[model samples]
Target: MARPSQLSPIAEFARRHDPDRFLCALFAPPERRDALFALIAYNHELARAREAAKTPLIALMRLQWWRDAVAQAAEGLPARRHEVAAPLHAAIAAGALDPADLLALADAREVEAEEEGMPTREAFAAYLRGTAGGFAVAAGRLLGAAPALLPALQRAGAAYGLAGVLRSVRSLAGQGRCLLPQDALDATGLTPAAVVQAPEAARPVLAALAGESLATLDETRTTLRPLGRLAVAAALPAVLARRDLRRLSRGKTVSLDPRSLGDRLAVTLAGFTGRI
Candidate 1:
């Protein structure tokens, strides 16, 4: 089981390794940072596979590769021999995280590939549990959090995933798709086609999503630990996300502009100070 030399250098770039992602990594033990890096890199790779593929089926095939790699790694095999897989396989051996979670994650990504538009609430929840929540739960074990924390981690992951979907609504709409729940949009007299074409017209939907984010934040309060920096780290992004949604609720649409340097610094400071 020798290590593989193939590493994804691009994943080492600052954006994915940026403060927020690093913040997430903080939950993992310092000794296991390399493993977490490999995991996050693999997650990014799985996500980008769709973008690289000529067809959705290709994306699904790539996802299956990752799932198989996870299984192989869990069984004391070399996984893929890639540099990322080396430390990742070691982590799997050490942590005893089930390979099924990895398979679930890949399967959920495949769902995104097959679906033409944003998922309904139920489908989105299922995806969150399998994908983001799966990662958080795995990370929780690495962080030495008790197993009970898995539910809390899942809730936090779902909240974050929902916020991401809401934020991407504008861009998704431009692609002739809308991520908003049909029921919610219907109540507001908005159609998926209309939202994609006239995102500004979906103000009500955006507002509702903003409110939902707030509720999720409140619901996760009991999960916070006294000095749980990871909890703070996880919640900080939600705060910024809520702020963004509030802006959208006001009038402005979701834009592709990067978060400001000041904002990143603010988040960094808040993360260090545990002020979030």
Candidate 2:
């Protein structure tokens, strides 16, 4: 049997930043770990590509390549001939997943590729459901979660993903991109450009959205709790992290200072200790 390839540098960076994702993928079935990594690598690379593109058309074209690759992989041609193909190939062979899920993932990328700011709650939720939820559901299938568990897992994943997007406001704004839709800001009588220029003022709105997302995660956590040891082992840290971020946002601090790193790490550790 062939081993999956190593992650590209960019993908490796993404893994480091998203330790929660790395840990979750690690706890997944050994047979599926490589594929999950490959998926993460692809997502990270594609996001970089989209961010760096000079034009939405160019980014969209590149995303099409990944979308087609997923389709071909489902049909056994294994698009791009890279590592993500390994577990995906196996999952397809086992009839554990559908190509549509991968397509949905690609479609979500397509939305991001356009470089349009998220402007409304509906649009933001749609993006989350399609992009973040899509990846989680596909990865969960590979991890051997029954189809019945997918909905709850997806809800949890979307909440987690939303938290990430909110946390990334500072980072993304530096890159000349913003994911918080313009419409939502407009409704608040704030221009999308203004929010991009001054995200601090948007803290209350962002915090409220983050709270809603965490609530969804709470529901997801409750559903998974009865499922036993596997559920707790896989999701507790992320749940704790989300909850911590939610609580931290209540302060609506003016700055996400470096000093906060200790607090974030503490939440992660406490969650790991089951004191969460």
Candidate 3:
């Protein structure tokens, strides 16, 4: 086991790669911030596994390693000696965090490895629920959110997750992947290849996706309003989603950069105001 002093590396990784969640962690109770960062950093590791792996077999193996590590940590056994795992083990052992939620997150990434576009809208929603929604539920637990608030957190996470997918459409297309559903492409008279080759022509398809995301975001905010400050804080990233959707609607390019000054200011205000 690592001494508490050694957890800085995990925090640093979260700060560098997941700045939005890293900023959100600052609004968490000081004692819980490190554990929150560990969870988010662990998410980053799993979410990027496909890109990091040259082969599907390698990605599967990497995900399996995380699955086994989470199971071991849940049983109070030792975990592998890696930066994210060590701190993740510490967080899980501390209670509040759930190994099942982490396992579901790892499982969700398999979709990225095996498929280019989701077959249906429901399938995409499920993917977001498992990955992003699961993370919010876990983070909310760490913040002592009540059971009633879980659904609200899941909705907020789904909205935020969908927005993230929309914002990354161009980049995902560049990677030879398209997260847009096949039905959506068909409706727009576009194809997966066209999304990558003719992004301008595909703007309407992206805009419709953004519209759905905005509606979900509205619902999330309404659901979380009665849950109080901590719940609102947990859903702060929805503010960025709303902003991105607005940009997409106006024919402006969505900025996926986490470190943008406008994003920083918007997130900071939402954190202080406890509204998204």
Candidate 4:
């Protein structure tokens, strides 16, 4: 195992690409942190499918390749020898992750790659259930969380994921993508294309979505109280998510990262107190 302060290749990949989860992984036990790092890197690859591919078809192909890698890891066969795949395979092979949950994330990223926008709030929630919720379930498993905690983790994760989506509204719009519900946009005289054309105009809609996310996070407080140290550590991102969601609730755009010492201190306290 790498020393607590040392960075391994997979850990470095996660640190560079998925800073939120990377920081959370630091709170894990040293011996298990590498597996968490592997999981985070694999999740990053899944989340980046749209950004990295030239065509939706190409993106689906990349997701399919990851699916195949997960299958191979589950079967104890050798992975295809990629940097992220190799350690990710070991994680799955060692029973630190569930193949089904990982596959669900890949499935959601497929929609992310293929769909233009969500047709309704229900559709958006379902997509998040698969991607963020599924990811939290897998991460909780890695932390040795009891099965009873999985459902709550899913809820917390989905709420956090919504905050992330809300935070990225301007940037996603700039990329010609809008994740807000089409029905809501239409009611507000905005279309997905319009959101992309003028992201600033969508602040009210984004604030509404942020309010919903905050509500969801608030619901998790009772469930989150059951978290032990490792589980609390795993759910620490909710601290920052809540912070951003509150800002978004007020119709203000915020950075994906606040880049403040307060962010770390908040997470540390949330982890230490077993509350999110």
Candidate 5:
């Protein structure tokens, strides 16, 4: 592992707050590593709005701050002072990041800021598209990946993102949160209260979602066959995402937390072999 002393501030922030993504970012070329980390770190801050805000209004205000910062950065103006802001602006100024995609990701977080959870299955998928999918698009651009390589990256992001959500069904249930589509919950005859009280019963629903995520990931693999190593690295986190989905499909109640050596080894192998 790289020492904190060696990693840039944004890189360290990324590793601490979003380790799985940090691992994937580490594969970018040395010169681009910091920019990738900046992107990840910025995304981390966007997610933080949920925990830090006192209410939905506060959360939306927090997200608006990021949108404002991005607008400033896009125009080469000074952005609001924040740990991640300068580096994020630097990434954008270098042409490695896109303001539009960053704002889109922030826009997605508005759903999270709302008191109501995702209204429907379609809305939930669209949320993931705007959040994780948008992040992958930014990372791919930063890595100098071909525009043609983006759809695969977005699919990889959605698969990995959904797998992570499904893996946390129990824990999120305990908190009265459900990442599943509202319709899916209704279809399963599971209510938010029911899930919180008996997370075990939510397994079938979570397993079905995991299977869907796994299928999405498998489809992405075919797209990977033609990508160069840099582009492959951009979506490499999908390897662990696949492992997680398989675990859920088998009814294994694994924690959503990273598996340290196992995760590193799996992605390292995929990175070396370019096999997805």
Candidate 6:
């Protein structure tokens, strides 16, 4: 187990790369916050595996390392020396995190790395469920969420994840990745090349996807309302999702700028209100 002081690196990593989750972790019980940070930091590491790797094979190797590390931790072995892995090992041991959930999240990232674009809305939703929805369920479980609430948490996560994908269309397009569903692109007479070459041509498709995301958010909000405060921490991403959806609906570029005053205010309000 890492000494309390040794966990600071994971905190710093979360604050730098995943500020939203860093803030969300703060809303957890003080004792559980470090574990939350560790879990999310691990998530950040997995999500960025491809970006950090020089090739698909390298990315797969990195992901396999995490998978092996998590398995080892589950078996009560020492964690690897890596910073994220150390804290993640501590979190899994302390929080009783499900190794299967973590492994499933890794698998989703591998699928993402192999794909150039989403083929259908259903496929996109499934991807979100595996990645973001899975994270929410795991985080909720770490915070002692009842088993019954897991499904709702997953729904909220899917909504938030889809919103994030919609917001990142322009940026992802630049990377030769298109998260927009093929059906939407076909309907809008837009292609992945068109999205990158001329983003304006895809506004209609983006707006439609944004609308779908908002509907999912609304459904999730309604479902989670019954769970009350127990769902708040897991649903925190919905704050940013709503903000981005609004901008997308207006045909404005969804900014990934984390320093925006509006984003901070939104997070703060969601934290205080215990909604979304």
lDDT per prediction? 0.61, 0.62, 0.80, 0.82, 0.81, 0.78
TM-scores of the candidates are: 0.78, 0.78, 0.92, 0.95, 0.94, 0.91
Candidate with maximal lDDT: 4
- Candidate 5 contains a number of clashing pairs equal to 0
Report the CA-based lDDT of candidate 3 relative to the real structure. Answer: 0.80
Tens digit of per-residue lDDT, candidate 1, span 60-102: 8888878778888877776576755665576678773556655
Q: Can you write out model 5's per-residue Cα lDDT over 115-234, one digit (the tens) per residue?
A: 678768788888877788788888887787788888888888877777777777777776666667777788889876777788888888877778777776887878877777766668
Candidate 6, residues 118-203, lDDT tens digits: the string is 77888877899988899999888888777887887887787777777777777776776676778779997877778877666788
User: For model 4, how many clashes?
Assistant: 0
RMSD of 3: 3.2
Give the TM-score comparing model 6 with the true structure, all chains together.
Answer: 0.91
Error of 5 at 217 (Å): 1.6
In angstroms, the error of model 2 at 69 is: 1.4
Candidate 1 whole-model C-alpha lDDT, 0 to 1: 0.61
The residue-level lDDT of candidate 4 at 18 comes to 86
Determine which window of 10 residues in candidate 4 has minimal summed lDDT: 1-10
What candidate 3 gets wrong by more than 4 Å, as runs, is: 1-7
Q: Give the CA lDDT, 0 to 100, for residue 207 in model 2.
A: 72
At residue 221, candidate 4 shows an lDDT of: 58
Candidate 2: where is the Cα deviation over 4 Å?
1-17, 78-97, 228-241, 252-276
Q: Could you say which candidate leads in TM-score?
A: 4
- Ranking, lDDT, top scorer first: 4, 5, 3, 6, 2, 1
Task: Please state the error at residue 152 of candidate 4 in Å.
Answer: 1.2
**Model 6: residues with Cα > 4 Å off, grouped in runs:** 1-7, 228-231
Residue 276 in model 2: shift from native, Å?
9.6
lDDT of 4 by residue, 133-156 (tens): 788888888888888888888887
